[model samples]
Target: MSAPQHPAHAQVPHVLAAEPPRSRPSSIEHELPKVGKIVFRVQGIPLEVTLEGLEKSFKSHFKRSNSQENTIDTGLSSLVPCCYGSGHQTALIQFQPQTPKRLESLAPGRCYDFEDPDFQCRITIDQDFMGSTQLYPTISNLRIEADVVAIPGINGHAYGSWTGASKQNRKTMWLRDFMRKDFHTCRTMIFGYHSALLEHYAHTMSDYTEDLLQEVTRARGNAEEMGRPIIFMGHSFGGILITHSIVKAWISKQPGRLCGSILNNFKGAIFFGTPHQGLQHLDELLEAVKKNQGRKALLESIKFGNRDLEDTLSAFKRYCQETKLEVVSIKESRETRKATKGELGELARNGELVMFVAVAFSELKLPENLETTAMAEGDHSSLIYEQGGYV
Candidate 1:
């Protein structure tokens, strides 16, 4: 079992200095310790981006000629459902030159300093997917350098010049995707989510749904054996995923009969912008709509259940019995136009749920000095692309 450690909370003091001096981490960079090392980072991105868009980000400019690859096998065979290996593990995957989008333009800087052991094994994606769980094999004398930043948002969002949040009101953000993988962690993770009745994942009834539990388990087991600490990172949809995974484990009521697929317990978790108690405004609105005009009227108001973000919040009350997991929430700034309804407060009060507040700041104007190269980040710029390092 990993020893319990306090949150490594960091705050960059706003400095009025002339130039931000070049800063480097004093500690040695983390290398994926075991074979088939997997790093899973979840990101909330607009739907416009595709697998192809990702193909472009890690190629030619991102790393050297032989840094990444198009495909690599995970050693696990066809029968094992969870194991996955990107064809491009050593060689960077490139985008078609004819494509109009120049992905690097999304972020201000094209040159990201990748410092991890296998710096070339960085995977770029609009959304952190099942393919994202793998770590590059550093044993091949992979010289570590600058950080391989996963510029978030859709391929368009990366360079499109629009920032706020996804229209879906997604609970995922930057940290999980772009940063967590930089340091090698020894743990396993399982993702779970209850079906949203009015939304995408719904069955004929809501009595009990163990839909994606098995797949999430297989994925974690693959990552664990490969030498990465498995963390079940969930958003509102994924929050439902983890919630149900644990509930299934607790329901079996056995010492070892886990939630269908998770091999054993997970090391730890860090959830950002998730709705644990449930979504407030939408649920009330849906309820009000149900009370007034019929279910049909409510359906029209909600974008045919797609915009009904509160369904997951209602799920906790409807399902899930385990309450022992330590969950943390990262809060949106007060400057947000649409305010989040219920907040679980700080870690001091809720031992299980620690909420981190993210404040958008104006870019600090610097008078340019050769002494400092630590550039100031735009208020809404993606953390992975902006700050670019471990916590």
Candidate 2:
């Protein structure tokens, strides 16, 4: 018997190298953080507190601390808390870079460790500050008007999914190769998150959407990028995430704010192999990975159908009606197989049989779109790494 063979297109080599980013700022500038401001998550404070109360609590803990009384700390430039009733109990602190370690020393774990009856919650540094710092193209001479933002699926690395050191090191990412030849003029930013979907501390889609908004705002800073056209590219579960973010922008009362700006910047989106409808069988997937498997987070996050997916899709359809944001959906044509319980058992019985073959094809029940293309030769994962084919 002959071994399974890939399509002719799959054999094509990635001959093109990634191009260097533009030196001058084009229509958009990817803003890097200056050491002037630091954002912190102030959790545990009662959600019912007034804006004034929130600020006062922060000041008491950071400024007039139990350790140091009567003296106001001069290092803090200002504390900007979120809106009074906003679910996010957070504050942004602008301070001198000279006292970098002061905030940590005060909060220890970035959580307020002080004993305050009114505000007893812990404070931690925002993920935007620690791990997923926005890294976009450096400001060049060009006056950038628009750009692209790419987000990877579950457990997908910000850089790796689109470029080097892929999740499994199987192939070079198509995004890297695509950008060089097709969308060279666009300034691209790859968004990353802590998508540990199964862990007790795992973040949900809403959390990811919020973080994405914050990251984009942080990267753009005071720049006026919202008025310009923006293109979004999401792969796998990222498609759902980007969709939710856009919907949030639409429903947001403050269209002038960061979340609003994200949606207001009308443009298009390209989704690759995103399960628009939903996946089936959480139990079987979980069984495959076992309780403590590393990929458990991903399966747990994506398992079967959930309300989040349906609600987001509904919102997405509404958002499309209200705006002219172009949509593109790409579905994979090839089928891939996985090991199954019965098949695995048979394999174990027959020493010659190495693995089970539970074959399946994956595709989205694509929402209405400006264009829909099918990658005839590609499967779920291969379509993503199809080397410069589509952008």
Candidate 3:
């Protein structure tokens, strides 16, 4: 036996000169056992799943678990409360009278944060855009959508008041109709439990971190109690938040004691359009960053992330830290998308958890009127919507 053989991902040349092969459709379709129930399709598959909270939190911003307890301000949550909903929309968002559950102004009865051992996450999306006109009208309700699928944020009973009047009957659901008599014959169960990215967006950065850690911890606790896989999935901005939080928690040792506390329970991660490198839409991201300049206040709140994104990812790959991570990303490529594909392939080859998936976006056929789509953009952001376009 000569030296140990390197895996294909390691032995292959960088091959940056070659363009990525034309992508094929991501034939992987998501399904569930029951049509509209919270039961897992495959009993043995796994029970634990988490769509991480914001990497930034406000309420839990100043809270600390310092052991030295000798000084003031040694442990605090946040100096200022987080703008979870739109801080501007004072009317649309409000916290519970005596609880941390942030409720929407429209649906005060709905609880954004609740504790239950039965389910690891209870997502509540309030996609109510009050601008009078909606940007993406294709979505249903023009309200909160789970996983970017264009559906209403109605609670309970899939067969909801599909054809009923509003206010009088709010039990109707749109996806239930699609699953009942669809041409594709897709399983109705996949749409069973709601998607986990139900962040109301009013959490402080620290609160976000702590909540994610709690989710991870809850997943592990659930696993220990029931035994299952602890998985996390994020897209776009969510992807960034998850990545940053992992580094901050384990590698940098910023917020809490994640290195020893929660690392053991982590199974793996699955990210769709997460930017491991940085912002894809540099202009938009740059503007967002600029508006958030000198975020010393915000920066101090984040006890996770390795100073930045690149450092966090690199440190993770090197195993320099331990956190809620086993796999980093699972991405799909459209045939002719302008974004980088070759780089994604390289990461997949590395023995890391990156995998290559294919998908068709918009069903846009080129000049030849091809039957299958290869040319597409990053559609992972919108994979789970009811309308089923790219998120």
Candidate 4:
């Protein structure tokens, strides 16, 4: 098995070689005082609106409220675009230092209407914990068996990516809400990062992989926690990131080190609609990014037939072979709607719908004993939430 290649063009932007291990006293660390931070998702935002404009609108609304006291210690912390659906844009808003009363005032499921001469839009607000990585509380009296971490793909939300609306229109996060019924003792977690298509300061693939490695290591602090068995579930491009991270852990030489422990305790992996070969619509997406003047570093790295990605896959296969890691690949059986130029100049889903990743590309050609392939009923985006036979 050959080691993974890191070509000159794919070098990390920052030096990470000398970084020391993060410290945590125990697995169950003491909880800190609440900072009164709240994050919400704003859906149906107009593409032309800037982050500054959105913040200003929120501030103006608060000022016009009758009770000015609620606005005293509250302020916008960050806003980033996220993928919700086709034909429209969405953003996540974070506010901090507000009282419990303020939180009740701006409750989840609340709707805000922003009206102006040029811009008029109604946005629905829902509580969001997209970028934070934390363990879900285990069921009482259930002895913990393993940790299952889920990572969302490109333009995917930590919460929304794995969530789907039920018949009653209630959002369901299957990993947290349903997985425990069967794997009763396994702790679940959702990992998120900035993978927006038009992000201005998008980090490199190496940067994201490093962040995942460090964050998860810190989350599972101490030797006992690190030695516990673990499984990873990744959707779309997230599967690629996991492959790289696992390969790094496999090659770590230091015995009893965190990275090596991750490799040692890695139990299995589940890939949802991942393009192990390459994305079919890479050219179209690249052209769109060029026309919009968005950053292209991340896209270029996953371009069709990219040599580096091919090498990474090769290395991952070798690791799996040596470790006999359990693997499952779930391919989308439906076509996904593509975003295209709209009549009002915003991206819409009027373009031709296509199967972005075919079954051949989604399923790896690993030995039959180690790999299993199945097809799911939904398109790429909904595959994560779909209760298909694959599960």
Please give the CA lDDT of all the candidate structures: 0.27, 0.48, 0.27, 0.61
TM-scores of all predicted structures: 0.38, 0.53, 0.34, 0.66
How should the candidates be ordered by lDDT, best one leading?
Answer: 4, 2, 1, 3
Give per-residue CA lDDT, model 1, range 186-212, as digits (tens). 211222122212222223212222434
Tens-place lDDT digits, model 2, residues 1-391: 1211221122111111123333332211122223223334333345465445655554555563334432212332122223222343433333333223445455322343455557555544332322232222323565554556777766455544553223333233334333423444455556767543333344655777888777766555444655556677777777777888877766775645586566667577777667665555344445644654555654555544667667777778767756745566655565533323355321111112211111221233334443334443355445554321111
Deviation (Å) of 271 in candidate 2:
0.4
RMSD in order of candidates: 16.7, 13.7, 20.7, 14.8
lDDT of 4 by residue, 1-391 (tens): 1211101111111111112222322321122112233445566667777667766666555453445433322233223323221344555455423433434476433444445434576755555344443333456575567767788887667766775655444445556444444345666667767665644555777888888877677657666667778787888888888998887666665565558668878888888888888776755556556744434667777766889889889999998888888787777778877655455544444457888788798977899787867777678776775321110
Candidate 3 residue lDDT tens string, 1-391: 1211111011111121122222222321121111221100001101232111111121243223553211111111001111121221111111212112222232522323333233333323233221111111122233211111111111111112111222322211223322222211211111111211121223444454454554443323322322322233344334444555555566555443343344433344334434455432222112222334433223232223325544655655544222313342323442212222133321011122221223221211122211112222323322222121111
List residue ranges in candidate 4 displaced over 4 A: 1-132, 252-256, 291-294, 341-348, 386-391
Candidate 4 global Cα RMSD: 14.8
After superposing candidate 1 on the true structure, give the runs of residues whose Cα lies further than 4 Å from its correct spot: 1-82, 85-181, 185-211, 220-229, 254-263, 283-326, 335-391
